[model samples]
Target: MTSANPHRPIRGGAAPAAHATLPARGGVGLKPEHFRHILDTRPDIGFFEVHAENYMVAGGPFHHYLERIRADTPLSIHGVGLSIGGEGPLDEAHLDRLAALLARYRPESFSEHLAWSSHGGAFLNDLLPAPYHAGTLARVCAHIDRVQERLGRRMLLENPATYVEFEASTMAETDFISEVVGRTGCGLLLDVNNAYVACVNHGRDARAYLRALPLTAVGEIHLAGHAHDVDAAGAPLLIDSHGAPVAEAVWDLYAYAITLAGPQPTLIERDNDLPAFPVLAAEARQAEIVMARQAALEAA
Candidate 1:
């Protein structure tokens, strides 16, 4: 896909320097269940990421422990309810809350989904998809600009795993993502599992989709678990369900993705069916092995 504005210089809002503090090593989604274990063991995790909305409360055990954890390790704030892709004007109140959270913690990285999750003041509690068209494109870019301008920091936008496609879409998913990056100067949270899931569901080539994306804008990578079910037509469907272990297929795709994008701040996300800290750390080790191979390949 051609860039939206080739002549326009890409902005540093999503630049690597914005995340220089976050190592290219692996991290896990910070969960309440593992809070004590993490603090006790102080595992060799590169960083810890959390859902920004979860910590929006002013004072609580979550805040208490996060303070201690932040003192020891780098943190990345991932926002799930920004509704950046929503058609309505960006929610000012929500933005203010997020800005306050960032100011309080000063995480190494902050990210939100490209999907919307709210309509009219009512929250859907799900990351809803948006059609990829010129009109929708303009709306998303403007929302991202406002997010950066209001928060006073560059944020990464993640590609959502979609089960449906819009007839209104005039561009491929990769092209749509690249257009967003080119227009907003935002970095991408390249979710390899999501790309594989969307490709399998849409009968598209996953590797081709990965190869086509603007890898230079990717400051981070995500590996997650998925479920295999059938669509309405009974065709095989891969759901982006982060309930189980990372699928081997997604891991293979991740290995290839990192080879192209080089080492990134890889994250292993398992929001459901939470596993033991050791199990998650073992998966992270697998990611480290892949990076090790990349180091060897580049050296050769």
Candidate 2:
């Protein structure tokens, strides 16, 4: 995959002068169920990520453990409710809260989805997709600009796992994302599982889809499992459920992605069917082994 538009640059802003950075290794989503275990055991993982909304409060146990765990290990703050693709202007109040959260943690990396989840003062619980065209492109870029300016750091925009496409979209998803990154100077959070799921759902080649992305801008990679089924027309339909373990097919795609983007800060995300801490830690270790193998191949 040749570089697509090499003019990508990190935008300037009043972001914090000093913040932690994610190492090019493997990480796991920080879950409350494993908080105590993590504190006691302190697993040898690269980093731990948590949803920004979970720690919006002034004080609580979440902060208690996170404050400690963060001190020892690198942290990545992932936001899911910013609704960056909304048709409306960015929410100032929500931005204010997000700004405060970032200030407190000063995570190494921060990211959000390329999907919308709110409208007309009502919030949707899920990450929704938007049409890829000039209008939506402008909106997404504007939203990202506001977020980077507010947070004072370059944000990574994760590609969405889509089950549907819009006829109104005049541009391909990859083109739209490239334009947004080139315009706003934000990084790309390459979710390998989402890429595979979207490609399979839309009958596109997964490897080709990965090749079209702005791989050079990928600061991190996400690996997750999906629920499989068939669409109304009996075609393969994969849901970004994030419930099961990383599938073998997705692992293969992850290796391919590493070959293109090099060893990124990969995260094994399992949001449902909660497993033991060791289970997640083992997955994180497996990701590390994969990254090491790919690195060795490049060396050879």
Candidate 3:
């Protein structure tokens, strides 16, 4: 018999704190703009994801609505400020707050980007890129270790959508992420939009990048939209702007990905130009349909 998820573990592994099993159906990023609609309607979403930084505060309407919504749905906490890929050591204070947040909410899954947004004791507002060399590799690995040890929970690392690549990068993005998984025993949150963006920007094969991922380590997937732009050479460049519906190429990449990895928890993220609930829900439904079709093919 074909397995439902090839990555499904057989024996003891990641604790519930690290990643509780999220339904493999589709979900959307929780936005404050849709808080009332979500609470009032209580849509049939697989789960809801939130930026951990948003809820790090002690209390307010955010937590007020979040706690209520969480009662009716699963929650996934995605961090944007841990700076796991930074050159400096991991922030003990941030990790402590993160741990406290995780304990308070007990989210089903937690993830962060592989890019660094902090440097020299200052936190930047963007998810900056990092070199994929041996030097950066050791630093990133240690940071991941610190996160897991302090939080006492497994975390998923996401791939970055890069507009530029470093000349010193000795390995491909896939290789760098694979090595991190091997060393840290952490999972991956495959971002299809990021893959498409990076491929288009670097002229790399998006499909090849997807196929090279360590499928068994993928705990979740993200789908979002990008903006059209031009590079210095007047070549087409895609910005990782999650302000609109996911593009067709990204959906195609997602279709191929589930075929290789099987049905996994997927989420639709929209941070800017926030649309109404139904709009994002429709995109997430498309993701569900694609996953269902792939599941049928695998079962056959």
Candidate 4:
């Protein structure tokens, strides 16, 4: 008999945290602009994801809405400030706040980017890329181990959208991510937009990149839009700007990814140029259609 998710075999020695998994359906990032609409209509979104830092506060309108929305929907807490690839030690205070937030909501999944954002006692507003050599790999694995140990839950590590590569790196990005999951027992948050953006920027094949990932361990998927530009050499460059609609190219890549990984909980992410609730909801439904087609093909 074939396993449903052949690539998701248990790794590492410890058991994963006992949390319910998100349904293999479509979702969207929960934005304040759509909160009231979501509550009033109760859309058919499979799940809702929020940035962990946004709810680390004591109380606010965000929490007020989130608490109510979380009651009926599966929640995904994605952290943007964890700096999992930084050379310094993991931030204990931030980890504590994250733990509290997860405890409160008991989200179906928790994820953070593989990039680092803080250095030398300073926090940056952007997710920065890391070199993929042995030294950096070891550091990343250690950080993820610390996170899983402290949070008492398996966390997903997302691939970063990079504009440049480090010459000192000895391993591929996919290889590095695979090693992290293998060593830490964490899962992968396969960001299709990130995969496409980074591949287009680095002159690699996007499909090849997807095939290289440890897809079976993917707990969730992210689909966002990117801004286009030219490099110093006048070649095409792509930025992972979550301000626009998902590009047609990204949608194609997403379809390919769905076929490879089977249907998973996919999220349509938009953080800028906020649109009405209906527009985002439409896109989320579009993802569902794509997944449904894949399922039909597999069953045939």
Instruction: Using lDDT, give the best candidate's number.
Output: 4
Sort by lDDT, best first: 4, 2, 3, 1
Model 4 CA lDDT for position 226? 91
Candidate 4 lands at a TM-score of: 0.95
Query: Which lDDT tens digits does candidate 2 get at residues 182-211?
Result: 888789999999999999999999999899
Candidate 1: which stretches are off by over 4 Å?
1-19
What range of 10 consecutive residues in model 1 has the weakest lDDT sum?
A: 1-10
Q: Write the per-residue lDDT of candidate 1 for residues 165-259, one digit (tens) a residue.
A: 99999988889889888877778899999999999999999999999898988878899999999999999899888998999899999989988
lDDT for position 99 in model 1: 92
TM-score, structure 2 vs. true: 0.94
Error of 1 at 216 (Å): 0.3
Native-structure RMSD, model 3: 4.8
Q: Model 1 scores what on Cα lDDT?
A: 0.87
Off by over 4 Å in 4: 1-17
- Local distance difference test scores for all models: 0.87, 0.89, 0.88, 0.90
Q: Could you tell me the TM-score of candidate 1?
A: 0.94
State every prediction's TM-score relative to the real structure: 0.94, 0.94, 0.94, 0.95
Steric clash count of candidate 1? 1
Off by over 4 Å in 3: 1-19
